[model samples]
Target: MNDSADVSTSPDAPPVTIFGPDFPFAYDDWISHPSGIGAIGPEAYGQEVAIIGAGMAGMVAAYELMKIGLRPVVYEPNRIGGRLRSEPFVPGEPEVAELGGMRFPISSSSFYHYVNKFGLRTRPFPNPLTEAAGSTVVDMNGESLYARTLEDLPEIYAEIAAAWDNALERIAGFSQMQDAIARRDAPEIKRRWNQLVHDWDDRSFYDFLSTSDEFGKLSFRHRELFGQVGFGTGGWDSDFSNSMLEILRVVLTNCDTDQHLIVGGAEQVPRRLWSDTPYRITHWPVGTSLSSLHNGSPRAGVKAIRRADADHLEVVDSYGVAKQYKAVIVTCQAWLLTTEIDCEESLLSMDLWMALDRTRYMQSSKTFVMTDRPFWRDVDPATGREVMSMTLTDRLTRGTYLFDNGPDRPGVICLSYTWMTDSLKMLPHPVERRVELALRALDNIYPEVDIKSHIVGRPITVSWEADPSFLGAFKGSLPGHYRYNTRMYGHFIQDDLPAHQRGLFLAGDDVAFMPAWVEGAVQSGLNSVWGVMHHFGGQTPVDNPGPGDVYADIGPIDVGD
Candidate 1:
């Protein structure tokens, strides 16, 4: 559903972008600055920096580092784009399934910077209660309610929405903090947010809801309904055990509201970043792109990482080729450090290692099928409502979204998008089995629709937790994990770090305060860019200081040991 307390969208009101409550740096402004990201000395020009994983974070770091004269040697075991994966149902066809990050929030300004740079198009995602979805179906405990908007739903849905809004305002000062963020008030944001970090870092999202007086005034069923059909997006019960601060950040920054889907697929952003040449590159010649720099492909998957010397780090690829560089940016999941790669213990301190090892990642599963046409749009004569709609249910198919390419063209439907326990239920099942289960669930909601008749191609499915490269879908900080997030997010600023940990920098959505968002990945990549540049004595332009330059004054708060 949509957040009832969303900021005013009027022309005069300041837009609510992801200007952080933590860090509070304007990454979009930094990247779009006329002076460019930064400049490195001539000594650092053409020096190779190893970047592991060709994901959004990896590609962004590679692209920016390449633009600033450094040669970024990228390594990837899987396909590029990482979680921004878009798989086509038919080879060379426009019909595709976004298996990874399908939704993009307008507040993710840094990510949109790259999207705008690549000229990728976007339209509002078909979220549960959004206009783009046209209609929504919320099925709870065997009852189904169809709504063109939140108002069309039962009175209880509105009560849940109001209760959530009241809780946020009463407990979190939602509007004031959002206003601070909108105005780019760093000091005010830090003041308000650091307090929240201190207070809510150890609490769970469920704890925040259950303990709130507003929610407590209502029945347990109200809370259950709230969890099943949550504000901004759909159900968030999967994240109930997650740190309240994490959920707070999402709503405060508007990460869940006003989200859009990248037209064609979200994967196009990174692919374009890989191939497109920047118009304002520094030391690189005209038409030089990451594609050209690596001769049209990245290096093989990284096998291990070790300290070659006090001043350099060595990376070994799957092909057994080992190379030492002054700097390396690892944009892969932090869990991979222990599982996928044979990383040396001395590369990081025990505290940092604990942070990395203790990091918890949530599981996710999605199943999609391409249909002959958008038959769901056809209206039902008896009810005068669409045959089916963007669905949210307590059944196995927790969320079902429709993608209408065109009336004539084949349409794609994400039959199921589930997380945590629901996702685990489908992990052992194959694509066909997963599709069967999702169809079974959907059948209960739309008994007369005959959905199977419209299906044209084989269904696609993915369980990110099953992937060796990505141990889980994305980082979901548990209660009291804020210290770990602080440790990871601040690792880029290495002046205080020991020599062993200095050259190896971390960048990814997982490393960011706002994990599972592309903006987090993009910002983390930019932070690593600044770290890598500074490792070689590079300096940002005076007019456009980098994140590292302002980090000490406004970095993420240290919750505790």
Candidate 2:
């Protein structure tokens, strides 16, 4: 790790991308003495493990593998937590801010592991009860509208939520049978997921909403909530699946452990995980894009393009100065990885590419408005009282986050807004479009106040999802998509390596699970580690099973049908 911190400056003092105690961990013969720094050893898994993209998933998997006696070599082009970037904002310098994956919902098991082991500071991120929707925000029809709380909301809309709850109990009750059928075959799974749950893959949220009682009861809310407020309609209609709704109930509702906020931001999670590890993390600037993916027997080759037109991965870096791992666990957004990695014609074959296409990420257009003032100091919607902090920023910014920042922006409050699906891809470039979007949104909220005045400075529109290094903010699933992805992908295993060949299998958010956010990525990466470990023993470790079904982890996710 470099002492000088990796940050950007704008004729002003730059905030520190990395700060805190120095490289407190030791780097001994990590390649050989695997047990020195981390919990695991190189020989524990019978071979070395290599992970690419040091984001939450990659890093967490690293921690797990190390604990189980696997020496995993992590390969990250720039800073770890690929998109959990936090640019600094120094007074009189460059404009840098934190880039949180928005904010975190309760995390899955794997996410919890890495965060707690690191001992990250904690804060409360209680659910939202009230919010303030500004006049500048658009409605389902792209017209302006104002809102406060669910109760303060339009009476018709309130009745819909009540209806939705009633409908949800009836519909969600049927999910149990659907889960069982989904595992049996695609057609049967599609039937339930599409008709009862929703037909998301080929339809819009609008089209799918009508199929469910919840939406039927909340017709008004559906037209506005799912159509314009939540997932957005176009991308959902254009390219998505009905499976998202059900899966989300599972994703958002359950977590491995209790949920809380990272005091400083998400950065503390990875920063601490990197602690006591043999491999060192060298932070770089905002220039990390992949170029190609070549299969070298057991070892897959990856090429990247950095800021200076320099090579990113080892394949791109000559003389192989880039570290080569026996196995690579890719952790960035799949689309970003796709751009840099070459899919051989065979890999890109219609059968394969079609599957790849199904696993694409959703686009976003957002701005993080930082201020020195106590912005979220308005009336509390959940309770008509003085509000301090909560999740209701959605009401305040029309579903955009308005409390403090993600690891990308530490301490300061940020109001985040995004357009799901194709609406995002239509936005302008970063430099011009990013700031413009923030200012535009701010102008609406503050109206006559030159909101820029409180601006210590931020990357307003840090288009990380669009960054070649990361295709989108996070991965979402369509109906029946995970079936093909997990069963088909992650099939390339290290043990499948030719007798004398040295290779590593890679897995991450994009590899399986249809979606590529924190949960999916961490789970997939964990699967990769076990797969490599299984390769060595000719069988899976006693603790885990192959294919890594979450149901397998917790003895089948109860459908409650």
Candidate 3:
């Protein structure tokens, strides 16, 4: 989906992965090391640790904690996978609607470590302008244009793409920073990225584009086109108000390019991690797993958390049962601390609470339908082109995707995927009405194709903001929120913290430098694992220091209050 000119790397250059410019640590390498993440003292064996959610972050923490000889008592209000939800269109069927976290970039090595551990296969996601998509159609202002590649598009689109590339190179030093990340040069990454943080922290993505000399020279229509069909993905006008640093981190880390989709569903990674036995585990017997320890299911939803004593914290579930633990890991959305749970104020410092409260979440919606066959692959006799394509448009149904199962199996179509304002418009609509509105929008594009005639069964839809369990989809940091992110991300390093906040830990994408990505969730989870281990008098093998072990040297820069 990238519209930028293909900047080819040297044939011998190392492939870029999400080795952070913020905290240039090799989480993927650390986890894969044979020595294991770390070890706790024998006294900590079988000790209980409360985990507040069953999402990827919580599951990763729980799995690792179980491996290191601790009992992880998981509590989930809903299903196993949080935003990695994959709902079967028809009950018991293999086909599913990925309601959240559908596309995963290859640079997410930390996340892929677990996916490979569980043996989950992956295929190229059908993103616009990609080979997997086959073709793409861009529709705006009552005009439609189809393209198989960037070269096939009109000259105006090419000019807009060039303008974007020029802006990144001139304003952000895009290539130099990416080269440092690919080479794993920590000092260079810090030197380059810290400057970006200092300069762009208070600026919005739109601000960056509007002020760039390259974009300034172009017409307003060019900027609008860039927003509607952004590089490496679809529309990003929704993120125009977010911090420029946030957008820069995404591109520098390659979070938007060369993505893949889990074969069954993204949810399988967390679900399998919960049940899969580790090859090497301490204290627990062979074949022991997080599932076996919990009797095949996690505990009920947590209702409150409070400090019970100097040595322990107490967790009360929705069922009114109370349990005490020396360590607790909270992996839910930060907002839930204020809305859903009755958390003790004294559990955290006032500054930390402010960060949690200030964190903003973006709204997202997806609508999907199953069809009798892959009718979209059929070529139109009159136009000599496929009846439809991966679509990006200004209509209410902002983006539409087609999923082809085999020739005999039923096909799936994501009728619409929208964010922010576009998503809010669908918030009041039901699944039937969502499908109706999406169909109406598509009919305007493909009037000759009878899309409704090929429908097979019921449709599926989700609005993340509507769910009380998750107020919104994921974190989208606004301008001037870098300090808040810094505060939340560094909370795991509790050495300077007062006694009251010592044993509690936070881990999730929202608490990471790169939010709305699975790698961030996984890396943050590992940080909590290190924090919990240290809390119980544990240490990483001297050969493999944890994120906390190297925190003072390579942690994220403090951009000041």
- Residue 187's lDDT within candidate 1 is 99
Candidate 3 residue-wise lDDT, 348-372, digit = tens: 9999999999999999999999999
lDDT of 2 by residue, 24-123 (tens): 0111112123232122233444344556667766766676565555555555656755566654455542223446543443434345545565566555
Off by over 4 Å in 3: 3-11
Using Cα atoms with residue i matched to residue i, what is each candidate's TM-score against the true structure?
Answer: 0.99, 0.65, 0.99
- Candidate 1: 10-residue stretch with minimal lDDT: 1-10
lDDT for model 1, please. Answer: 0.91
lDDT by candidate, in order shown: 0.91, 0.43, 0.91
TM-score, cand. 2 vs. native: 0.65
Q: How do the residues 1-561 of candidate 1 rate in per-residue lDDT, one tens digit apiece?
A: 555555656678788998988899999999899999889889779999999999999999999999999999999998889999999989888788999999999999999999988788899998888889999988999999888888998998888888889989988999889888988999999999999988898899999989999889889999999888886689889999999999999999899998999988899999998999888887899899999998998899999999998888999999899999999999999999999999999988898899999999999999999999999999999989889999999999999999999998999999999999999999999999988999999999999999999999889999999999998999999988988888899899999887778899999999999999999999999999999999999999999999999998998876655
Tell me how candidate 2 scores on lDDT.
0.43
Question: Would you list the clashing residue pairs of candidate 3?
Answer: 2-232
Candidate rank order under lDDT: 1, 3, 2
TM-score of 1: 0.99
**True-structure lDDT of candidate 3:** 0.91
